[model samples]
Target: MRIIILNNFFSGTAYYCFKFREYRLFWIAAFFSNIGMWSLVYGRLWLMRTLTESEIFLGLVLTANLTPILFFSLFGGILSDKHNRLTILRITRLFFAIFTLITGILIHLDLIEPIYVIALSIITGTLLAIDIPARSAMIARIIPKEHLPNGIILYSIIFGGSAIIGPLIFAPIVSVLSIEYLFYLIGFCYFFTVLILLKMNLRLHISKLEKKISYSRSLIEGFGYIKTQKNILYIIILGVIVGLFSSSFEILLPVFTDEVFLGDSRVYSTILLLLGSGGLVGTVILSISGNHFNKLSVLIFSSICLGLLFVIFSRITNLNIALMIVPFIGLVNVWKGTINTTVIQTLVEENFRGRTMSLQQWSWGSAALGGLFTGFFAESFSSPFTLLISGILIIFFSISIGILLLSLFSKIK
Candidate 1:
């Protein structure tokens, strides 16, 4: 076991360095952005708990952040097409940094309240709704088209790297130092990210703004494009399924920690770390593989593999087994990062890249909207049963989508 683990760890590390050297500036900027993001999320959740001491409030706060994406992401996409993505990112990052700093000061002054937090979250969400599309689309500008798959993988590594580092540092620092100070730390990360971004000479890929269409038609056009492109829709549907059910591992894992492992906060943290480590490994694999395979087939197979792993994870009662599978969960996420985004970007024209990405984000927004609520039910009822059901649903849904796409492909051929 030790030998296997060491081998995987070394391999993951080697891949990260090789791929990271490809986009030095964006890679550094991504690391900073993810650190800030992780800090903000940890601070936000902790702040809510400090204010209200209610799980319901925690759920509500998450919902508030997600709600705007469900509604306004389309507009975000439209804006991405019409403007310079770098400029959009710079403006939003500046505001986001300021907001983080102000929130820290408010909390330190004991002026914090649920309303303030919720309102701040809403404002942050509005910025994120715009920022995400620009950020995702900016990948094409940063790396060579042939290396886009590697870019996606490296992006995932940064994401998972943040996941590994963020919470590990986050929980302890806040508990020992002050939660208010954590916000300040996040603000610093963002400001540093802005500095890093300013130095990069990214050739802005701007799509021409066509004749003004009604807002409804603009949105309809994004959907219409996907509808005609069966492969794209297939990827989107699989994304939604994975987002909804297969990816609920974090929510469901606490039960495994408590009931199976008979563990506390310490054990929970360990599991989370293992999961993050797994993700890092997965990202490295995808980064090295680059774009050697059919991305669509990779997506379908990885989804099924992820679902099966979840099913196995749901049934396991032993800590040893849980630890072993943690990396596989991360592996699935790496698969998700590479295939999902690459497929979408390849399918869409530069003009609609933003909106199309935004439409893709809707799957996430909708999933979060649903998952948080369902989680409450799972807690109230039985967690193990809830996890089992969710895992099974993911397996069936993803496979069915894959089959449908396969049949469609056959007909076209």
Candidate 2:
């Protein structure tokens, strides 16, 4: 029996490894690095709560981390277009790995004050501003065009899966192990990611004409081009709306666990893991089959379903049923992530890919800000009501965006 189980596990692992080889080591490094990133997040948030015991403080810390993204994202986009993406990614990953190590040391030494956390947040956020754009732009370079959509779906799958699993593992580890050690685990993963990145031979091409343009012009031109794109605009606007309503809800997961679920850490852990499961399922469906479907229609239908799932999740009193429905959230997440990226990647010119992706990052950051606000506001009143309001808003927003998209696409045709 044991041998049978072990064989099954190894076979499943080998299958995924085979699928991932199409993009080579670049995607593997990214997958591991992403897991570390979320692990760090899980550690950071748990550490923050352990220290401050204030939800507001957590929100503030998140704000500090994201504020720089709002400012420097455009610059990062410009660099992505003007430089070698793989090289840029390697440098940033190394810097962040070192930072994670240093941060871990400080935590171990009992030097992790709020001010230090703030400083670390800002520095890490700045590095991410550059790294994220480069990473997103580099995706197209590593994979064949025919496989780009699958690559995107696979990217979402692993990323969302990692996001779920990282926290599940970290939370329990922190419960038994010292919280400071979690940072060490994160650093080690990051170091491994850097090693993998170093080994991957990838180069991004920037044309001479594109090089001649000023950085400011490159940044503005990308946005200008996107402004004239009907599909891109609709997607971005709809994405922002959904993000504003749902993105920050994760920040309050700890609170909901404590208050609604009676301070059970197991329940808290389950919520996050379940969310990841949903995302994984969503990504699998999209990658295997949804690529052949109409992208716009997928986005519209998924957005509506996502909103409804949130509503159902909001009303559930039973934990088991809630867990069952949580994977739907992940499914919607995969749909949103894949559709948004595929649309932009297909519509934008090669030269403008970085800037446009930066815009996507910006939309996320901006939505995070809104989400943070929504979190605090909802917490101040009632958590359940907050979830309800967020769900309703998402539904309304999706309907409006879908109708607008239909009208615009028709006119374009």
Candidate 3:
């Protein structure tokens, strides 16, 4: 009776992965942990904007967080494949808790600076290079193959829900206590994640699929799969484009709330809340539909939509219209991600899944480079102009490279 109720509550395949005890608990823990992490991130952005009042510093913080992943995630993926994923996850989360608490202490002492914040982001990024792949690979270990899509979709909802809930939760706390408390709260969340990770029992090992190979060989093998699989390569490339250009929208958000909307942190929080709400809705709809979509075609169409939305949002002068448009932007973004991630998860073999996902993350991390460009252009010109040009680039890439890749993909199949 309870099983039936749970299934109905989650809706459709969303509950398929939840039938597993490990996934159910992991889902809950990941949700709250992400909320804490994202709230900390939002708080950091607010703090950076307070300190520097420069778009560059805002983008720099993101760059520091992502750049390490771009360079180091492959090694992390290899480690995930070779080591115990749960152990890696637990260790990283523990360090994250410690580091965040220390940062909070610094801030509480009024000793925190922009450089310190950037340094902490760099450390977190390095940890994520390992943590993300191990964490993602663990999902495959715990869930059955037939229900991977359900796991992926439901897992994504954690993030979508967190994105909304995080800032909303942060606003009141930071407003009442201070930014340091937000960091302190984030530290507690990571500690909780570490605790939950320790309780997970994953004796299953996919690493046995590959014999003891040299580190270089393993790295080459992962890259080899991507090189040979032209379609997957196409998807990764397209993701790079999306990450690079669409990212400017976020990089400019603090600027938008300040200069464009003429408001403060509350306004910034409201925009994040709307964006996250749209993402949550989009993920839920996908989950209910059983991820039944033409993966390739929908991916392309969503890319075009994202590019168009970025252009529209940047050009519009009306605050109300812009606010209305932000949600749509969030919707398209999550849909593209859900389809892309599910397709990759389905196609890649278990052994290569960690590496492939790490690469996918690396492409997404190009947002750092995007942020750099965004900050540069916004500082040199105007935020609107920066975003307008970025939108045009996304459209150009989607139409040009996207079409060429699709043509090749169809012919090969």
All candidates: TM-score: 0.84, 0.89, 0.95
For model 3, what is the C-alpha lDDT against the true structure?
0.83
Query: Residue by residue across 1-413, what tens digits does model 3's lDDT show?
Result: 99779768665666667779888877877886788677766777888987888988888888888888899899998988888777787788899899999989998899999999999989988998988888777777778888888888889998789989876876687677888888888899988887787777857643654557887999999999999988788888888878888878887888988998887777788888889988899888878878566667877888888889988888876677888998888888998887778777888888888888889886668987987998888999999999999888888888887788779877987
List the candidates ranked by TM-score, beginning with the highest.
3, 2, 1
Query: What is the C-alpha local distance difference test score of each model?
Result: 0.73, 0.74, 0.83
Candidate 3 residues lying further than 4 Å off, grouped into runs, are 1-12, 209-211
Worst 10 residues of 2 by lDDT: 10-19
- Best candidate, TM-score: 3
Which candidate, 1 or 3, has the higher TM-score?
3
Per-residue lDDT over 1-413 for candidate 2, one digit per residue giving the tens place of the 0 to 100 score: 99888766544331233344436687678878888787765566667767786676666666666667788888998898888888888888888788888888998888888777768877888888898888888777766665666666667777777867776776677778777777787778888988888777653333323577888788779889888887887887888778777755666666667666665556766777777777777777766663467888888888888778877777876667867887778778778767888777767777778888888877566654864775587658766667778788889999999999989888888
User: Which is the winner by lDDT between candidate 1 and candidate 3?
Assistant: 3
Evaluation by TM-score, superior candidate among 2 and 3: 3
Q: Please give, for residues 203-285, the per-residue lDDT of candidate 1 as tens digits.
A: 54555657476666777887887788877777777786677765356545544666678875456666767777877777767
Pairs of residues clashing in candidate 3: none
Model 1 stretches astray by more than 4 angstroms: 1-23, 46-55, 111-116, 211-217, 252-266, 315-321, 410-413
Q: Which portions of model 2 miss their true places by more than 4 Å?
A: 1-22, 204-209
Ranking, lDDT, top scorer first? 3, 2, 1
